[model samples]
Target chain A: MSRKFNFCAGPAALPEAVLKQARDEMLDWQGKGLSVMEMSHRSDEFVSIANKAEADLRDLLKIPANYKVLFMQGGASSQFAMVPLNLGGKGGTANYINTGIWGKKAIQEAERYMPVHLAGSSAEVNGLSRVPRQFEIQTSTDAAYLHYTSNETIGGLEFDYLPTSDVPLVCDMSSDILSVPTDINQFGLIYAGAQKNIGPAGLTLVIVRDDLLDQAKAEIPTMFSYKVCAENASMYNTPPTFALYLSGLVFDWLKNDVGGLEKMADINQRKAAKLYAAIDANDFYSNPVALENRSIMNVPFRLADASLDKLFLAKADDAGLLNLAGHRSVGGMRASIYNAVPEAAVDALIEFMNDFAKTRG
Target chain B: MSRKFNFCAGPAALPEAVLKQARDEMLDWQGKGLSVMEMSHRSDEFVSIANKAEADLRDLLKIPANYKVLFMQGGASSQFAMVPLNLGGKGGTANYINTGIWGKKAIQEAERYMPVHLAGSSAEVNGLSRVPRQFEIQTSTDAAYLHYTSNETIGGLEFDYLPTSDVPLVCDMSSDILSVPTDINQFGLIYAGAQKNIGPAGLTLVIVRDDLLDQAKAEIPTMFSYKVCAENASMYNTPPTFALYLSGLVFDWLKNDVGGLEKMADINQRKAAKLYAAIDANDFYSNPVALENRSIMNVPFRLADASLDKLFLAKADDAGLLNLAGHRSVGGMRASIYNAVPEAAVDALIEFMNDFAKTRG
Candidate 1:
């Protein structure tokens, strides 16, 4: 069967190679006589799969030994509450930099548990189009941790510079995690939902400093406690085994097929550049984000005429380019060219975009 | 490739037909040109898969209109905390009947949120071998709700009867949810991890009465709120799309292939009965669990000569009977005959058991 290009924003595309490998091994994982999904989490075969995935991830990111990698469930939204419940238990206000919808969500969830200080905000500049600069961030003296969304998937805003604070730095890196090289040592905690750049939707990847593990509130649920999860190697409960197995295949793809994150970033930059250049070349399409702060992962653009929006999406679907619609909250077009999205898909999308603009402009 | 009989407690054996379908559709789901894992939970294609799965599950269980089925992440372990946090807002002591390891863990987690009164326990009878009778249970005068483990996976204990209570009833049916039909109107809420009898490990199924949805504590996380999840149709976030898809397939298998739970129970009962009879017939092998309270899902038996345990497991493995070893907490041999484990597998296990006893006894 022929495949189509998918650009779903969150539960987005996965590498074709990874999906192929998973398909081949779905019935009997490595000749083990049963599918990986059918194996116990504590089984020797699954443990090896789990360990290798974590190792490949550490190698790709150059993650510090002092950091613990947690393969968790409940997505990044769970981490929104976990970040505060774990870090804000000591009676300190959480410092947050509100960049877009995702960052605002983290702030809102954190506010449920403790007092929150708005260290910075994208609204101070040009609404959701631009990310707040590092210098604009103001941390409270009693800050528990400074939290921000590294890339907002919906609004297409990204941080060009990492904000520093005396408090621990926490980030929600859901949309842009494996698309680039990241310094794991710079953050106290970093979490990403696996659907976008990692693997699938159910599994969540958490990289947190070991020291921060014990900072959870006394009332923390055992499942949400990083220390408990880390201690049990994220097997406090039956992990999403199939999701973890698929994610391991993704980690393998990232390391071997894609040649690591540096190569990934180069390809991502080129793809984003060509697409943005096409958008800016004609008045038929326009993207409002600042050039320096634009997100390479999620590129949101609007047609010169609002009436062509439905037609553009329908034609895109006809051309086998799928899920290009923007967030429901904001009506437009968005192309989430994640790491797994081949550059060929981007080229095809750009070609389709130019053709659509010429004929329908 | 040949398939082997897997007796793992969980993530246990899945129907070969289910795994085959999953393998066949891994890359291109229903000719949609992308894996179910890649499709957005909000996409029409994915939504159709989700809705059909829910409908099939409701049909299989004969769920009532007053109950809302929530497809959530974080497994049954997360429900250990959620049950208390959601239902204990008014501050009455939560009544629990502890039977085995899973039940004890649930009680410990519940204690962190509210006062817990042990209404009854298996230890009161003998140990974990016999379930505490309904008449023996003594609910507290200030009981907010009564919680019980319908079937404890670890100890091979299945409750013989449902305990009656004036307060709301909450049941953790993690191990025996879909094995047999039951009256859903008897309980306030029922939650189960999907790995054992449902589908896989990542998804948790919650069927909560609509009236109980609004009783959550104000401090509950949005992800943990039944009201919020039901309102969003369990799409408050991504909601584990692939796991949900796979679970739907399992429901399809139950309804279409197995001809509903009555047929499934017929097969499961025969499988368990034959295995337990073999153990009872021979002095070389024995199971401590009571006859009436024995779990039809997991059957744990031990050799009279404990020294032969390792050899028996090895010989069973060599014969393609895999994962015969019991849980690490309790050392023995366990043959989990969940719905997916064919009757042929049990015949093979019995043959192997008798052969081993003849030679090694």
Candidate 2:
């Protein structure tokens, strides 16, 4: 049976094939008579699973040897605290580019550990655009790192290009990590919470450069220290075993079933374009973000007739298009077309939007 | 088909019924056509699932209305840092009773936040016994809280009674929670990583008194703040949904199949007694912990002739007894009899031990 298209901002849809494979393996994982959740993290069986998952993820992203991939817990929110706690050595200053809600959160968290300088901000533009080209980035020679949210799930804003700076770049790719291809070597660190495009909610994937690993403050707890996690293979403690298992399945699915990141990028772009075209086709609906900076994974749009917002949602829900409601901050509708969201689902959503627009217009 | 009796220490065993229910619900949950993993955490459907799980937990534990139960991410290791970050307000000192590896780690983490006084320790005794009665606990009037490890999985040690102090008692009950009955009111705070007796690895359960809520440092991330997690109903961010669902099933199984905590406690006592007796009856096997303070959940025993240890483990693995290897720090065997470990499994292990001991002797 076909599944309804889910446009949840996060804890979002996973590939049906991946889910089916997981379901089939839920009872007995490779004839081990144990679900992956029940196995000891240190056991040979789990070690191989964890190792293969990391290897496959490395291959999918083409991560550099200098970057260590750590599977952690507590999501990106935890990393909001951890990034500064570790990277802000000696409580120095750092650069923050605020594009939206996630960037603001990252800055708020970094403030506790160091002086966070606002390098660039789009919030002044009413949270609908990217970092302005003319905004000056005041980079101190001693600044620990320059941090930004690559894609804002709530604001539906994304950075079209990385800011050019001498300082190390750290990006929170929580909402849009593997949806498209990018230069992995440019950033000192990149962290993504896996609930959106990856697999499950509990696991956070961190890719950190080797040089930054040992820069954590001595006062930081071992669990939060990037060096400790990297050294121990993110098993400094019992990780979210099931989440990691699902993430491994997702990585494998991306490599084999989805035809790797290049294909996924193309498919995701098509999905976003189809939905965005429906919004731009008539004055009845509008997407405020600039075309060049619009997110390929999340498309936030609104009806011209404000009174029709609730009606549109009700009709969409009735038609089995769920969680299309936008963030309250944005006050519109958002369709998060992540890797797991099939092209057909996006086509269906576009059809529904067009049909709804005809009556509303 | 009947399942094998698994004796893994953690990420250990879960109720077969719970696993079966999870398997059955893997594809479509209650006709939702979405697996629990695929459900948005913020969706009304998943919200209800999370709420019911919390309510069931509170009901099973008979937690007071004044206490808040938080289903958090990051295992107990994260709690080691978070407890200090939240409770160790304004550089206040706290007392930590070091019983085993977990306690030592907690102390190390807490020391980063404030001056942690070592109220008592069992490490000098090789982590075999609980905190010594002769040890004096120096509680400062300004201390934040007193901490202890209720049960140490690595070293088969457990507290026999509560420490006599007016300070708020905090216990890391990671290994022993839900295996027996206890007074929930006695603890000002209790946190357990869910891999052992609760449900899965990703979720950590924290029970804290309401009065302790406002004591956290304001600088801590909102996600790590016990106050924020409680206020948001543990929905501050996307939680481990599938983990929470499985945990709810385990809670139900605990209520019905295991005859609740009271009955489980009695059965656990009997099971521990039977196994300990077998080890003590024959000098070929020995448990180092003082008999009165030994853990009923984790029984770490060693052969009198150490040369036969490898042989014993090899034979045990062939017989489907896995993860019986002792922690590297403590060179022996550990049989973790969690809630899911049936008495029959303990009997089988004892039978195997006897058969092996005869030949070694």
Candidate 3:
């Protein structure tokens, strides 16, 4: 049977090739007579796998020499708390740009540790637009860092440019990472949950400048300490071994098969354009976000007639286009087109959407 | 090629049947047309899978209605910090029993949050034995909880009985959680990392008394809050979906094919006995732990002639036995016979040990 295109936000779609390789190697990996999942993290075989995963990810993102790559657990949400606990030492405050749900969550978590400054926000615009130029950024010369969500999944909004700041720039790039290329050197720390564009849900990838690692609050847990995780190569405890292995396969797939992030950016641009064009071609559907600052990864649109929402979802499911329902916060539909989503899948979804619209209209 | 028996401590062996089922369903789970890994956590299909996994685990352990089961991340080590942060609210002390590496780590982490009372300890015995009855278990009537490592994985030590206390009992059951039948009602909280006796390495299982859920410090991250995790059904963030799904398969294997935990306890007892008998039969190899309190899961032994250690490992590898090397802290050989270890494997290991000893002698 043909595979379905999964549009899940996270625990999201992975490259079929990676899944196939994992399935084939589930019994015996590299003639070791044991599955990768079963190998001890201390084993030579697993050590090699873990090291390669980190090295390949660094290469793909062009990570600078001063940054340490850490494979952590508990997803991006966990990092929201960890970033503050590690960076917001003593009574230091940090600046946060609130864009949408993820940004607000990060700000809320950061508030638990120290005073958080809301630098800029698109929340007043319902997160449908980018932060306006007239908006003021509350920067503290003595602040710990500036935090922002590069991509907001639930609200289908994204920041195209990095926040201009002298302070270390920290970002939650959970939804948009690896889908497009970015300047890794500009950020002091960047973290992304693996589900959307990496591999699966359990693993979180953290890249932090080495200079920023030494100042964790004295009371923070060792597991939450960036210094401890970096010192032990993220094996301070038994890491998500299987998740790391799977993510390594994805990194290899992205580099060799999917043609790296440069090519991925090109292809993603095309896919997003096609879907957006289809939505904008007629008045049958509407995307509320401003066209200039629209997100290329997530496109949330609504039917012209609200009554057809259920009908659209049912027909889409029948056609094997799944997880098209938008997050409850927004009522219509959402199509998450991460890096693993092929152009053909988006084309099929557009075709299906057009056909359904024509018949219903 | 035939499969070999693996003895790695964590990210260790899983049931062959579970691995097979996981591979079979990797691309499409139960005709869902999407891999379980790709499904959204909020999807009905995955929600049902998560609910069933929790229900089955509760049934296996006979969990009381007052307890809540939560699937979390960051392994047992993260829980080390989270437990104290949640329970030790506003400057309260908790009692800790130090038996081995895991216990020591727990103490070090807990000290970051609140005062930790060194109640009972066998670390002075080089972790070769469990805590003696004469050891004082200091407890203040106002103590937050009593924490202990039920089975020390690195030190190969196990607690024979619970400490007498009216305070809440919290256990890090990472290494030997389901190896035998457990009285779940006795403990306020029991947490296990799913690597040794469970499924994979990413997911952590926390069984907390419902009444203890509201005790999380408001400053704690929402992801680490027991109340938040319980309210969202462990899907507060995207859970380790693939890990949880595989763990569900393991729960089924344990309950159905393995004749439940009672039968598993008997089989595990027999497996440990066979290996221990070999060590006892001759003076060539010796296990330092006392017999009555020996762990049924991990058995660390050493040769009388230290020079033969490498030779023994090479010969064992040639015989398709792997990961017999002990942790670096202790220099010896360890054979961890967790629940997935079949009787035939134990018999083969015994035969190999006898032959090696006879030849060397």
Question: How do all models score by TM-score?
Answer: 0.99, 0.96, 0.97
Docking class for model 3 is medium
By TM-score, rank the candidates, best first.
Answer: 1, 3, 2
Off by over 4 Å in 1: A124-128, B124-128
The residue-level lDDT of candidate 1 at A2 comes to: 82
Look at candidate 3 and tell me the lDDT of residue B316: 90
lDDT of 3 by residue, B28-147 (tens): 888888899999888899999988888888888888888989999989998998998788765578888888889999998888788888888873455347564534777765688989
lDDT of 1 by residue, B1-361 (tens): 7789999999988888898999899889989898898898999999999999999999999999999999999999999999999998888999999999999999999999999999998853454368777788999999989999999887889987888898899999989999999889999999999999889899999999988877777889889998889999999999889889889899999999999999998998999999999999999998878888899999988899999999999999999999999889999888899999999999999999999999998
Q: What is the lDDT of candidate 2?
A: 0.85
Write down the DockQ of candidate 3.
Answer: 0.77
Candidate 2: list runs displaced more than 4 Å.
A123-128, A134-142, B90-92, B123-130, B134-142
Q: In candidate 3 chain A, where is summed lDDT lowest over 10 consecutive residues?
A: A126-135
Better of 2 and 3 by TM-score: 3
Write one digit per residue (lDDT tens) for candidate 1, span A205-289.
9999998987788878899999899999999989999999889989999999989999999999999999999999989998878
Ranking by DockQ: 1, 3, 2
Off by over 4 Å in 3: A123-128, A134-138, B123-128, B134-136
Best-matching candidate per TM-score: 1
For DockQ, the strongest prediction is 1
In model 1, residue pairs whose N, Cα or C atoms come closer than 3 Å (at least 3 residues apart or on different chains), thus clashing, are none
What lDDT is reached at residue B175 by model 1? 91
